[model samples]
Target: MEDTNHKQSKFQRVLDFIERFGNKLPHPFLIFVYLAAIIIIISAIVASFDISVTHPGTGEEVVAKSLLSGEGLLFALETMLENFTGFAPLGLVLTMMLGIGVAQGVGLFDTAIKLTIEKAPRAVITYAIAFVAVMGNIASDAAAVIVPPLAAMVFYSLGRHPVAGIAAGFAGAVGGFTANLLIAGTDALLAGITTEAARAIDQDMLITPIDNYFFMATSVFLIVLLVGLVTEKVIEPRLGKYDPKYAEEGILAQKQEKVGRIEIKALRNSMIAALVYIGVILALIWPETSVLRGEGGVLVPSPFLSNIVPIIFVFFIVVSVTYGISAKTIKKSGDIPVFMASAVKDMAPYIVLVFAIAQFIAYFNWTNLSTIIAVNSADYLQSVNFVGLPLIIIFILVMGMLNQFITSGSAQWALMAPVFVPMFMLLDFHPAFTQLAYRIGDSSTALLTPLNPYLIMVLGFMKRYDKRSGLGSIISTMIPYTIALMVGWILLMIVWFLLDLPIGPGINIRLDG
Candidate 1:
């Protein structure tokens, strides 16, 4: 029996090792979409199973709900179709990526990286690396698109392990993406759901992107510290000894576009235009009679203040116009539509995927089965009357463990929220606080998982520098960061909970009334 167990462990290790290598050979997005398809099928099957649990609210035992039933499947299809037609982030992403794509296509991103490498103080590399990782999300592709290769080049240039550089950059990009300081797809989705939950208690919960700014801004530093320590102290050291062969080959990373004279002019114009736009916006919002506010005053409750969405629209428009004019993409105003059209074209596939995803999410919720199970599960726990803080900690750990399987934070939140939000609410915890907890849990595991499509891409890049690199290599490298991050991050949440700090504006872990 002992021999058999040992052999099984050895075989498992070999399989993981192979999977790591296999991962390097596949494209990140391809693997993501592929696995997404698998997850969809598996989740659908999981949903289809007639597993049962008692209802939390009523303490009544119940059977698992069936999506196969009439009305269930119909509801699913209808919801998914709706997602395809309206409210998909596809359009927003398309528009944003156009500006980003053009910027990259024109060579500014590479220039930006070169500037960082040239000027960034060596003492601050960790934060600089992490900061670039954070801001890269502005393009949403810069991290995967730019960071790894750039890191490899920088490391090789500086006489450090190129794999360490790639690993750190890869981790920062994907992992940091999970938490953004402002409006993003995750924020939008979470906010929409938050509005839903808040309405249950108070019809008006105008939670905005900056709703949790206070905590999140602070979280940025905490994460940077955590990532920096893990990367510098652990990841880099373990990766040791720069491969001189890599140096001999002189395999420096490539830049797509050079910020030549044309791009420089475009960049200048764009910056100037962005500032001008901000000045006008600030002038309007800063004063009482500027007419940017609501009905109470010229600057009060007015459409200008409420029109944040259009501002988001105008921001892209203004920047795109400036960049295009300077770069000669737009000779006249008429050229603007062409750029916009191109942007929209890129989003069509993402739109399809989202449409499918949204349907799965909405359909699962409508069935009431997920909520029922969550409630019952919470009830069972409550019946035992376990320690509150411990239970929360345990929940966080469970969320971390599950993150290895489910990589999409928003999708996972969509499913988990409908369950935990209501269940935690019953336990006197506010939905926002619970949502925040879910974010931390989801993020810490993202870097270490094979299921993360981006991780596969990162692995592939790692192997480029070291042919022997594979899945086990990626996981082994990332595990230290993951373990370190999990410990510190969970502790931060614990302190926050104990201190009774507001998770966000008017949002608490426990509800009053």
Candidate 2:
């Protein structure tokens, strides 16, 4: 009965999460705010009894962090606001978003997707769609905007049910988003949070966002193969082709714009430019004389790795700009401002949302919630001697399920890191292992959550091809691969833990002092 109740309670939480967010869960920033408010109200009530933790750091310290105090409350709010605004992801995200607008403004991007459909053959379309989805992040929500529509086009043109096309794209795009091998902005953001959490126990510990890049990059191929197999062997055969035989199920389709003369010219130039862009990167890394390579390797703290996101942005921007000019889609330099303005306008709501979140995080910190929880929890775990590889897997499962309701990777990490890092540190475990667990969880469950705003949008795209789909349809399809990834990932981590290999040159699970 207790087990049943436990499952039911979890289910109830999922429902509440859905109800509160409805179609849109509170933004990560705003979620931080609301959580802070809850903590404040509860702390206020708890403080009436004079309840307080003895400051665990210094034995003589008896510091009080009550949300009930007028000054205390204000300080908390201010701190959270500051932290949110200062979060590095904010700037990186905005810059990327702005850069993405250039590609969108030109008919260049839309043309590219349609052109992809014409390029790849039907049998390989499934894998191609998935691969493209992984590449789409360079364009900021381009997966949401382009993949679905492109999937429909691919399916229709090739005489397959467009719904299958839609699902193929949606699953590949989102399910694969978290697991990409290259250290993109998402890796940097999560890595920064992981580093923050890890440092709580050992001040000098460090972790790169792409610490597990080689392993993760390989996972991409497994995902593509699994998703493609499921799509081709199961989904396509079930849905049938897009011709007259499946006539009742209208695979509603549309025609793409022509390859106009100017676009044709632009296409030739852009393709050449794209090839050149890739060639230059190869040249840099291949011979020691080029820019990307540093003393040891290009993939290390090398300039190329650090600045890859910008390079990606520049590549897209230059190619798109060249296409725009050559194709006559962009007439003058003034059009650049117009594109930037439009993109920023779209981002206004997200910025406001993050602002609200920032305030809440500030409040919680001011109340000593984060630090206290982190310290005490770490102490408790140390006393119990419960930190190790096995514990990491357990938490991964918990965080993975939790991710269904709380979709933002950083938000979830921020909440858990303070508590987990300290505790794990006590057990002679480094924070990086725990963070790896978090990443695995955060990623595997991204595909299952209805709470993620993108989830529904992807589904709607599927509906354009198949009206009978739901969250279950998508989840069921990807379940096999999800299980594979979870199991395979944990197994690999266990080996690493046993080897006692250092996380990085100077980083370790426990502090030497």
lDDT string for model 2 (240-285, tens) is 6554443235445375455566666788898888899888878768
For each candidate, the alpha-carbon lDDT, in order, equals: 0.62, 0.65
Predictions: Cα RMSD each: 6.3, 5.9
Which lDDT tens digits does candidate 1 get at residues 1-513?
999889767855764754466456443245435543444454456657655665534566555445566665575566655644553334444445555555544444455555554457877766677767655665555666677777776666666787877776776777666565544445545655554443322345444443444565566677777777887888887778766554324354543233467766776777788799888888768766555666566532256633454575576567667777677766776666655565456655555555555554454445554455556666777899963688777777788876765555655665466567666766777666676777777777777767677878887788778877767788778777777767877888888878888765445667772
Q: Estimate each model's TM-score.
A: 0.75, 0.74
Candidate 1 residue runs with Cα over 4 Å from true position: 1-114, 193-207, 246-269, 287-307, 327-343, 360-381, 386-388, 505-510
lDDT of 2: 0.65
Against the correct fold, how does model 1 do in TM-score? Answer: 0.75
True lDDT of residue 225, candidate 1: 78
